[model samples]
Target: MENTTETTKLLVSDRCDVCGAQAYMRVQLAGGELLFCAHHGNANKAKLEPITLEWHDQSSDLNQA
Candidate 1:
């Protein structure tokens, strides 16, 4: 497994990697970390892999269940 704890530093610190806007979702992958503004996260989810880690704050869609 990759050290996402360390990779977190390499990911965008403040803004979304896709649109460079305020990030509403944080996409943590095995090999890379990504910060996505709500638009991009929901927009590109078809390409983003789902994660198993516990996210303190998660997308409302999941919380609905």
Candidate 2:
């Protein structure tokens, strides 16, 4: 996958790899990308964070009205 910045955000159509829920976080590894919703993102953060190349998180948007 290409390198992306914080501005390179995910669209609403992006789906989580774990449960097909709307994806709000993208975990980029050397091989590929892994998408996750807020719940799964938080759940797998510990394991994924160490090996992650880039963690594009947008779960903060969930708090907005």
Candidate 3:
């Protein structure tokens, strides 16, 4: 058995690469990491999903207080 843990997380300070909004998703690819806000994430999902290694989504956290 093996144990694995998440090494990176998208923080409030992290901004979307496209829009400069607070990032809620972090996409890991061969090139590098791409941070995205909810809007941009959904817009590019079709293209990124195939090549993404990790999709670190934290949008649900927005509802938390």
Q: Indicate which candidate wins on TM-score.
A: 2
lDDT of 3 by residue, 4-44 (tens): 32446667799999999999988989899899998899899
Best-to-worst ranking by TM-score: 2, 3, 1
lDDT of 1 by residue, 2-64 (tens): 976444332235677887975656666676667766678778676665652322123443344
Going through the candidates in the order shown, the clash numbers are 0, 0, 0
lDDT of each: 0.57, 0.90, 0.85
Q: Judging by lDDT against the true structure, name the best candidate.
A: 2
Least accurate stretch of 10 residues (summed lDDT) in model 1?
Answer: 52-61
Model 2 is weakest, by summed lDDT over 10 consecutive residues, at: 1-10
The candidate with the higher TM-score, 2 or 3, is 2
User: What is the alpha-carbon lDDT for the whole of candidate 1?
Assistant: 0.57
- Candidate 2's error at 31, in angstroms? 0.8
Return the lDDT, model 2, position 31: 93
- TM-scores, in order shown? 0.55, 0.85, 0.83
TM-score of 1: 0.55
